[model samples]
Target: MSEWRIYQGVGKPHDGIDRLPAPPPWRDFGNGEGEMTPFDRDMPAQGRHRLPHAAAYQADESTVEAVNTALYLRRPLLVTGDPGVGKSTLADAVASELKLGAVLRWPVNSKTTLRDGLYRYDSLGRLEEAGVAQRGARQDEQPTPASLGRYISLGPLGTSLAPFALPRVLLIDEIDKSDIDLPNDLLDVFEEGGFEIPELARAADVSEPVMIRPADGGEEVTVRRGMVRCHAFPFVVLTSNGEREFPPAFLRRCVRLQLPAVSEDEMRLRAIVRAHLPGADEQAEEIIELFMQRAATGELATDQLLNAVYLMSRTVKEGAPGLDGVARLVLQHLNVTAPAE
Candidate 1:
């Protein structure tokens, strides 16, 4: 197994690096007589869509420094880079390294909204459930208190802000793909460290601490008075493909870092390749050079290189020289220049 370096705070405040005190644990907050369960902290080493490259992914010093700065300052890291440059994978790497549990990923599309990322209340579902209970009950019996807990669940962002022993890792993937107003809407929640669920708030007066499930489908957590606040701010990673520009205010609140484009650096390429394709060190140089050459001509992603290498490796092991043609198909450049209109 490869040894991973966890991000410790910087020694002094320099180049936007500010030292910060350790975040307080959830236990520090007072817990009244109620069932208080922490967010699921037990994340398996592998899962569907989880990055297998997390353990061995190698980041440059500057990227590492920026991540540490974000951690210490309790600010979101806005990572801008081309697709497949490992923007989304950064969240996985950090979570795996810091033992921060499963990453809460909110994949943004044009239809995604602030409410979609926070929480969703199924009012209709609750009403139907209530009606069923009332019909089955005796004339004197009362229906359940809406059973809002069953209908209301926190989304990825909401779950991240839930008071946890340690901060959770949140990946707001491809913010550039979201609607224009989405970025601005996120500013308030990011600064406030929480949001209010109106449905839960209205019922707060009548109910005990409501137990709600998060989007991860993990253990239930108790939300007091329908407001979800972070005892420790989540380690947020917002990725962009440089498709759209963000407002000044949103950019100011985030710590921005742009990953390097294509590079011929042998060590960097080897580290990345070795993570996905172990024991391919002998073929790293040849494949990495070919990848760089292709990337120079068009918009080629790093994953394309990995795919090509994996196919080539299989062919070599099986002594199938004829399979070289099939391997070339995988290495084709994804982007072609548009013709003049």
Candidate 2:
């Protein structure tokens, strides 16, 4: 069980500046094909988690190329656009394309700390040990990595840096929600390819820790000091809603990609639908188009269109009404409460 602690302190004023990593002299080997070598074969699969393939929805050829660049380069892809413009989906799509595990999401917020993004040490277990020792109960504990591992579970940010051939996808969602320092803080890990866990590092010198993994139906991945080395530098994707400006130093480390709104011709929307629902009929496409147009006018959420299509299809399969029913189903899926009649 995880417990969250809220820390209170006098808030400091924003200086609007922080130290950032110097850009590595990256050589543009952008060959005509831009093919990248696969991750090392011998690398362990500790932090390399894969995502569900069907969820990946690529907008076009350019989008695929952009994602490939970020993945091969192992650099942060800064995706900016209006809300619901699939900024976050880019990471998911990449993970799915590569068959990497579920996208590790770090939803940024004003109060989110660097430690929160990295890893947190569990103090409860430590306190329990202190209590046991205070009563003068002498006990010999096994040096299993599992016993020393609970304090060192990596957060999404730290997990992204795990050393493995198959890299994980990390979506830093809505980074604009954070203060200016967040991006700068992230630069080090992005460049260095990993972060150090002080707790695990300290314990590692004592004994070779064991990693406790789920027993197929197990619930947790309990890891010891040397049991896992997450060498897989994550294909990091950071998204913004364009709420705030970023310093140049932070931007230099990442490749910036801007996604425009869905076109009126409905090219991207149609493509997304086809990718998501290959066998969807004409009625489903029409309903999805309607939802997409409606969404385009307001807070255009692409996921809502997907939801609408699924709901409409289910309704039709159950032998419900036609276009009107489909529209109603789309609206219902979007949770757009019926307007005052």
- Which residue pairs clash within candidate 1? none
Candidate 2 residue spans exceeding 4 A from truth: 1-56, 137-148, 200-230, 263-265, 292-296, 310-313, 316-341
Number of colliding residue pairs in each model: 0, 17
* 74-172: candidate 2 lDDT, tens digit per residue: 577899887667787666555443445566788899988787877666778866865676666655553334455654466777565444335566788
lDDT of 1 by residue, 60-104 (tens): 777887887788677899999877788887888777766677899
Q: Candidate 2: lDDT over CA atoms?
A: 0.57
TM-scores, one per candidate: 0.84, 0.67
Per-residue lDDT, model 2, residue 12, is 18
- Highest lDDT scorer: 1
Candidate 2 has a TM-score of 0.67
lDDT, residue 292, candidate 1: 75
Candidate 1: deviation at residue 332, Å? 1.8
